[model samples]
Target: MALLVIAACQLMVVLDITIVNIALPHIQSALGFSTTGLAWVVNAYTLTFGGLLLLGGRAGDILGRRRVLVFGVLLFVFASLLGGLAQSSGQLLAARALQGVGGAIASPTALALISTTFGEGPARNRAFGVFAGVSAGGGAIGLLAGGMLVEWLNWRWVLFVNVPIGILIVLATPRWIRESPRHPGHFDLTGALTSTVGMVLLVYGFIRAAQEGWRDPYTLASFAAAVVVLSLFVLVERRSRQPITPLHMFADRNRAGTYGMMLSLSAAIFGMFFFLTLFVQDVLGFSPLAAGFAFLPVSALIAVGAGLASRLLPRFGPKPFLVAGAVLAAGGLGWLTLTDVHSTYAGSILGPMLVFSLGMGMEFVSLTLMALSNVPTRETGAASGLLNATQQVGGSLGLSILVTMFGTAGRSEARQQIPRFLAQATPAERLRFRRTGQLPAPWSDQVLTAGVSAAFVMAAVFTLVAALIAVLVIQVRPSDLARLQGGPDPGPV
Candidate 1:
């Protein structure tokens, strides 16, 4: 029952990440949001969720895990209700951010509860398998659900739908779960503040650069603030009696590699969803429902790979899975980059998506096992919180960076093609294009295509780097395996 509750909470948090994406267009249209403002719907949630995760994890330690879990679910439910009822863009964005705060609190606490409830052998392994399965499957499920809600019902249903799920989980949690005792430690307030603010500023800078150029005053200020704040955060962490992010978490080479791999892999996966959704709806002219259905193959393959990895991980170790998954993902992204205006789904999209899913599925499972494998039982919450935080930060950083790159490349390519387009056009056609303040039709195609391609290339490069790190830095051998399994081998990495 405890595992079930944890899995349910995880599914809710993960599902929220992608579900709103499919509804972005609908929300934009309804709310009359500017192009840049629409991004905040997703960014707001990600920023708060990622920023507060460290604090949330510690909260679970300071307060009872069960208490924090219930409180988070209730908070999430209320935030969802606010989002559902929002009449303005700002209202909705605030609600989403609040929802993220709730998620940050619930996610680590739930994982901590799982570690406390399950024994460290088959029971724990099986529980983790289920947890990992839900985490892997939730993104795809969100896409599907988001599409159905936006197409059949209303976009608000996407937000409203979480209310019942949150209620059910909150009720069941109290009945089934045992509360973890609170620990006595000072919260790392300074570290938490610095880290959260720094990340928000950094992400904001990239997002602003995407819209307003790198030299924009706001963008420059955000970047400067991020650097300063992050520096302070590190300094604070070094001095804190109980740092929110312990420095020793990165002491183990394999664990550090696992964290890095997750960061890159998450960036790649989130970027894929972001750009692919645009390609399907804007370029291919698919309805939200069709686009959602299009992701079915990728989703199914990911589930299969995750299940397979969980079974194999206990035997072959995490290195093989990580390396293989990264290679496969890079290949998949490379294939996706080949897509053009005339490319068919089967030839261009489906095959590559399947390959990408294969890598994503295996990479997530293997990295998850590696991250949590050696964490001390007492620090499981902190470790899982750090893992989740890296993923969130990576996604935000990757998307912002890619968006800026895409915007700049697309704009430059569009400008260069304008002269050629005007030369081939009649004076009246040229006048009409100038009147609209939009790029010439031919140039527009080139720009959008180039932008998407650039994003994919960046994603591929990030995954390739992760692959290299997995192979070079992470050394999980048979002897290490013996230690992990608690045999008569020397303990500790």
Candidate 2:
């Protein structure tokens, strides 16, 4: 029952991350949102979710995990309803931001519940495997669900669909989950506020840099504010009697490595989904539903790889699989960077996506296990909260950076082609180029391909960095894991 409740809550939170991508176009049209405003639909949720995750995790420790989980579900449900009925862009963005708060509150509690419920051993390992699979699979599932909902029904149904699921989970929680024992630490209000505000400012700066350039006054101010706030947050954490993120948590070398690896890998993985979705819809002329279906292969491979990793991890140790997964994922991204106008789904996209998913699947499972492997029962909530927070931060930061890169590339390509079009073109042709930021109809393909290729290259670089981090850091062996679990120490890797 605990597993079911936690898994369901996790599914809802993770699904929201990608589910709205397919609905963006529909939402923009219906609500009459400007291009810049439409991005807020995604950023609003991520900003709040990433910022407050540590606070939410700490809340679970101070109060009760079950109580916090229930509150999160209720808040999420109310926010979803508001979003579904939104009459304006402002209302919808506000609702999405509120939904992020609820998600932040609920997610860590779910992981903490699993840690407390399942004793550390094969049983706990298996539970975490399932949990990891659900976490990785949620984005793909959301894409598919969003496409189907937007195509068959109105885009509003994408938000409304969560209402029933949220209600069902809330109803089951009282019966299914038990309350966690409360700790005697005071909430580090100062730490939470500074960290949350710092992250928000940092992400906002990167995102705005895409539109307004790095030199823009607001963008520079945002970055400067982030640095000051985050610096203060670290100072506060060092002095606080009850630090929200205990400094001792980073003492474990393997755990620290896993956290860093997760941040880099998550950035690449989430950026792929963001740009790929845009490519399929905007460049390839795929409908929302069709684009969703295109991701089915990758999704299926991830599930398979995750299930396989759970069993294989106990035998082979995490290092080999982690290294192999990272290398393969990097390779796949490299292949994807070759995408061009003539590329076909089977010949060009499918192979790389499947290979990438396989690597991501293995990496996610191993990294999750490594992160939680040596966590004491008392610190389980804090550990899991930090891991989740890293992924959220990575995703938010990565997407913003990649988007900025894409925008710059697109503008540069457009600028290069303008002179070519002007040299031999009539007055009407030059006017069209000036107005639409591209040559007349036929040259759209060249411009889009260049932009997408540039984005994919950036994603590839991100994945390569992740692979290097895994190789350099994360050195635990199967025997070491056994020792960590109370068995004999195996020889070092």
Candidate 3:
């Protein structure tokens, strides 16, 4: 029962990362967001959630996990209500940022609770497996749910749907989940604030560059501010009595390498989801429900691949899986770069997605094991929070880079396509084009496909970099391998 409650919280937090992605088009249409601005609909939630995760984890250790979890769930529900009622893009973005705050509080603490609640053995292993499965599969589940809500009800329901689930989790948590013992600690507000602001500025720089070119004054300023703020964050962490992220944790080569690999892979994963959702709907002309259902196979294959990797990991160790997984993921993205306006879901999307999904599943289990291996009991919470933060931050940063690629490619394609579109348009269509300055049908589809393809090429580069890191940087020692394979200290979930 306790596991169910914890898993439910994990599902809600992780799923929120992608569920809103499926509804982005509708959200854009209703809110009057520009193509580039729409990215914030996803980034707003992720940036805040990723930035505050360490603080939230420390809060769980200082206060009880159950207490913080309940508070977080309530805040999340309130944010969802706000998001559903939002009248403008700014209002919606604010609500999404609030949702990320609630999630950042709830997610790490929920994972930490598994460490406290279950004794370290088969029971804990089973519990962690359930949690891992939920985390791995949550994105696809969000897509399906978002599809249903958007098609049947409206885009607002994607945000509103969380209210009921969050309410249930909040109500059930106190009765079923036990409180973790509190530890004495001080919140690193300086470190948290600097890091969050720095990352937001960094992302905004890339977003600005995508819209207004690299030489734009605003883009240059954002990058400058990010560098200064992030340097301050490093200084603050080094000087703090109790840092949110322990600086020395990265000293271990294996752990540092694992974080690097995770960052690269997560960036690729997030970009793939964001762009593909747009590709299927806008270019292929799929309905929202159909687009949602399109990703079901990815969920199934990921779950299967994860199960298989867990079974085989004890025998072969993590390196083989990491290398194989990265290669497969890179290969899959490479294949997806072939997509075009005429491409069908069966021929272009499904096969590559299945391969990519399986690789992601395999990599996830190995990455989790690698992240937690050889860590001390006292600092386990910090380690886990750092890993989760890397994932979220990587997604935000990677998406920004891809969007830049997409924008540059998209503008070039649009220029070439305009003459052709004008040549082929009917009298009424030409008037509409001149009035609104929007391309119709085949021209729009071509431009979109060009941009998406360029983005995937970069996403493939990210996975390939992960593969290189796995091969060159991550060295698996005998002790670490044993620890990964159910040694005395398995580390936290």
Judge candidate 1 against the unseen true structure and give its global Cα lDDT, from 0 to 1. 0.84
For candidate 1, give the lDDT of residue 204. Answer: 83
The TM-score values for the models, in the order shown, are 0.89, 0.88, 0.95
Model 3 TM-score on a 0 to 1 scale: 0.95
lDDT of 2 by residue, 1-493 (tens): 7787788899999999889988886787799863334556887788788778888887898899989999998999999999999999999989999999999999877887887789998988888868876887788889899999988998898889889999999999889787889976688889878887898788788778877888999999999999999999999999999887787888888888888888878778877877677667766778889988998888888777777776777678888878888888889989998998788777888899999999988887778778887888777667877887888778777777777777677677767876777888888878877786546644656666676677778878888887787788777877666755445643331
Q: lDDT per prediction?
A: 0.84, 0.81, 0.90
Residue 359 in model 3: lDDT:
95
Q: Best to worst by lDDT, what's the order? A: 3, 1, 2
Worst 10 residues of 1 by lDDT: 484-493
Candidate 3 lowest-lDDT run of ten? 484-493
Candidate 2 accuracy as lDDT: 0.81
Q: Give residue 202's lDDT in candidate 2 (0 to 100).
A: 83
Error of 1 at 5 (Å): 3.9
Number of clashing residue pairs in every model?
0, 0, 0
Q: Could you say which candidate leads in lDDT? A: 3
Off by over 4 Å in 1: 1-4, 32-37, 115-127, 308-316, 416-446, 485-493
Q: How close is each model in CA RMSD to the real structure? A: 3.3, 3.4, 2.2
Q: Write model 1 residue lDDT over 345-408, tens digit each, in one string.
A: 7778999999999888898777766787677877766777788888997887777777776777
